[model samples]
Target: MKIQQITKEVSIKRSVDSGTEEQRKTVQQIIRTVREQGDQALFDYTKQFDQVELTSLKVTQEEIDQAYENMKQEHIDIIKEAAANIRKFHEKQLRETWLYADQHGSVLGQKMTPLDSVGVYVPGGTAAYPSSVLMNVMPAKVAGVKRIAMVSPPGKTTSLPDGVLVAANEAGVKEIWKVGGSQAVAALAYGTETIRPVDKIVGPGNIYVALAKREVFGDIDIDMIAGPSEITILADETAIPRELAADLLSQAEHDMRASSVLVTTSQNIAEQTAIEVERQLADLPRYEIAKQSIENYGAIYVADNLFQALDVVNQLAPEHLEVMTKNPFEIVKHIRHAGAIFLGRYSSEPVGDYFAGPNHVLPTNGTARFSSPLSVDDFMKKSSIIAYSEEALQRNYEKIAAFARLEGLEAHARAVEARFK
Candidate 1:
């Protein structure tokens, strides 16, 4: 880890991978093939990429039940509890269709409607992401989305991880597909013979998945193109060095591109944290990945004071921020940007990642400066409702016509005039 004096120019922003031209071309071809061949394309891609020949694209209820049998009862209970917390949190974000009448005898407002269907892509490679399933699907379920389809790349056994299956079941997702990568994204964006198209697609994936989402964006709504994981810790003299190091590494282990930064007012704390990060890297299960992440992207900044430290934090606008100051609450008010704030020592980043009510799917790569975490709103669409009474139209029709005429839209002007006539 590198230690440096905090400056206004300090930045942790990494260039987002837009995929090489070859990869983009590959993704485009895959999407085109899926559109043409449908289920045959999905099955063929699954065989080529995942090395699994599947008779069917969807996961059966029997497989889901067997997934339960494979997992211990205690693990199942934990997944259920986590799902409950996620659902409870997202349910609060649900809004009802609303309208208001004005003095002009016009009813105007917005109607909130959940999407008819949604697709959630859970990546499968070296590890299982049951948490991803819960975070992405629960919000759509809370928004009253009728159908939530989940897709994950199957392993050699031709099935998803037990935990991923259990999480989907707990999250109330009935449609699970045993396919992933660019092909799965294509299947979601365009309907297959078996898998129907979804109105929106959400969840994280590899570069190919991201590219597929980008290609199909206008056709179907998609969650943001996520970047690598990031954690920026803002601490003071009262903060413990070891705890800060541990928290930083938690994100570093996620990916080689993941960034872990510490901004503090204490010079001693900065040096100690850098040392502790190196010390802790030796024991992490993903040791090489974390070590490389720290060496390349990790940093400890020494700030003159709390205000200066906060300035550095806001500039980074990290996806996950930990405030380990003496008074975390006071510091929070000053924090203008952060996807998720974990205050105090007890509120570790992983708490929000797994068990906490807040959605762990957050903005990364400094997007927190303008973007927000995934929420129920992402799964719902708003329709503007405008009802102008006869009296109101009589009063405003001329003004509306004149406005339309100014914009060179005579048809629009005539339509309002015809309404009045």
Candidate 2:
């Protein structure tokens, strides 16, 4: 089979998608008004964006109870298991600040503190991913966040997705609001009459939600401005065509603009994988979405060698990357960028997204080169503690004064000089 031609050159700008621009601008306006007018603005936007009218902005306990009553027991059990696994994985990542004392009475240490509260934004755009609820909320719980609040746009008449409420209940959420979209983000970032503002906001949503997060970043912390979903498979002759095909199809179902690429050294393996993809697409329920995603951004490149495939992956820095080859370990070390690296065929992207101990809330669109997967660290802050004894201060006061004087800051020099003067 002939390998497909690569793009003339990598789109360094990565094609800034403008399809959602109109919605994004509308959302921004909603966020601004929501920030100024509070619950009234939320009520208005909920009607406009979500096509719902609501009496209350917060989901009542009675409503949550009813939501639980309506859901099937089997689904509840599955959510329970997923939450437990997610909590277990994040628990291992929790860390404590440390302190050290020198020979003198000076103490040097960092005090780790959790944010007072964090807001989780779950999109109610057509579906509810309980997995996302667990992934976003569990980390804050593990980090010891004092208050965890969630917001999701309710259906027309302000009704939340059942699974979202159930997942929040399972994850120990303190409050759940009947709001979604950019307006909800505004309410979280800037406190409303009923909803208290939080120190950080996280979770995924559509482009409107993404841009809203970007705008409100400084007012309150945000995890990341997520891009479209992506996956890249690095394979050679030893890989299974069918399994590779399944992996590619998995990410393709996320959105039409999502990218899925296969970089392989062996022409034979590349040909087989392509055939495998077509065969599997026939049975996929989300075939149109998967097909469009693959056709628009998908590709199979014939690398000169296995090393060449590795180089390509490093450059792309895909959100989900899989290495399926004779020695996956040898390839893993050279991978400089990628949100999550799945080694060997058994370690599929779905595994990490669901049950794996590592967080599925990862950096996307080449941001992995500098950013990282959501972790306990994101919810915690460090404050340095420094204490110098009188003897130590006397020893170093002149030096400190001299250094401050060199910088031409009399106040700084005076502060140090006063200690010994």
Candidate 3:
């Protein structure tokens, strides 16, 4: 980890991977083939990429039961409890269709409707993240989406991970598929023989999956193109160095591109945290990955004061921000941009990642400046409601026509005039 003195506003903006020409071309071809061949394309791709032969695309009840058998009862209970917590949190974001009327007999409002269907992509291979399943699906379910489909590439045994399956079941997802990569995204965008098209696709995956989402974006909605995990800790003299290092490495271990940064007022704390991070890296199972991440992207900045440190945080707009100052609440008001804010020493970033009610699917890179975490609103669409009584129309029709004519939209002017006549 490198330590530097903060002198001016700094940006930790990383270049987002947009895929190579070859990869983009390949994704386009994959999408085209799935649209043309449907289920056969998915099966062929599964065999080629995943090395698993599948007779069917969908997960069966027997498989779900077997998944339950494979998982420990305690693990299942934990997933259920996590699901309950997630659902309870998202249910608060649920909205009702509303309309308002005035004395003029004009009604205007917004009608909120959940998407008809959604597809959630859960990554497979070296690790399985059941937490992601809960984070992605619970919001759609809370918004009253009728169908939620889950897709993950199969392993050699031709089975999805037990934890992933259990989480999906607990989150109320009925449809699960044993396919992944660009092809699964294609299948979700354009209906296959067995899998129907969904209105939107959510969740995280590899570069190929991100490319596929980008390819099919306009045709079918997708969540943001997520970047590597990042955590920026803002601490003071009162903060513990070891705890700060541990929290930073939690994200560093995620990927080689993950970034861990500390901006603090105390130089002593900065030097100690850098040493603590190096010390902790030795024990991490993903040592090489974390070590590389810290070497390339990690940094500790010595700020003149708390105000100067916060300016850097706002400029970076990190995916995860941890405030470990003496008074985190006071510091929180100064933070304008962060995907998720974990305040004080006890609220570690991992708490929000798993057990905490907040959705872990948050904007990465500097996108936190403009976007937000995945919520129930992402799974729902709003329709503008407009109603005008005859009296109201008579009063405003000429003015409406004149305004339309001012824009040289004669047809629009005639429409309002015709309504009045």
Model 1, 237-269: lDDT tens digits are: 999999999999999999998999999999999
lDDT of 2 by residue, 1-421 (tens): 1256444434322435543768777767878798789999988887886788898888888877887998999999888988898889889998888889887778889999999999998878777887888999999999999899898888753678788889899999969998887888889999899999999999998777788888888988999988878888999899998999899989989888788888888888899989999999888999999998887778888787776677788888888899999999988789999988999979998998877767888888888889899998999999999988888788888999899989998899999888757
By TM-score: ranked, best first = 3, 1, 2
TM-score of each: 0.97, 0.94, 0.98
Span of 10 residues, lowest total lDDT, candidate 1: 6-15
User: lDDT by residue for model 3 over 229-338, one digit each (tens)?
Assistant: 99999999999999999999999999999989999999999999999998999999999999988988898999998899999999999999999999899987789999
CA lDDT for candidate 3: 0.93
Top model by lDDT, which number? 3
Model 3 alpha-carbon miss at residue 127, Å: 0.6
The RMSD (Cα, Å) of candidate 2 is 2.2
- Model 3 CA RMSD to the hidden true structure, in angstroms: 1.0
Identify the runs in model 2 with alpha carbons over 4 angstroms from their true place.
5-15, 18-25
What residue pairs clash in candidate 2, if any at all?
52-157, 152-179, 153-180
Q: Is candidate 1 or candidate 3 better by lDDT?
A: 3
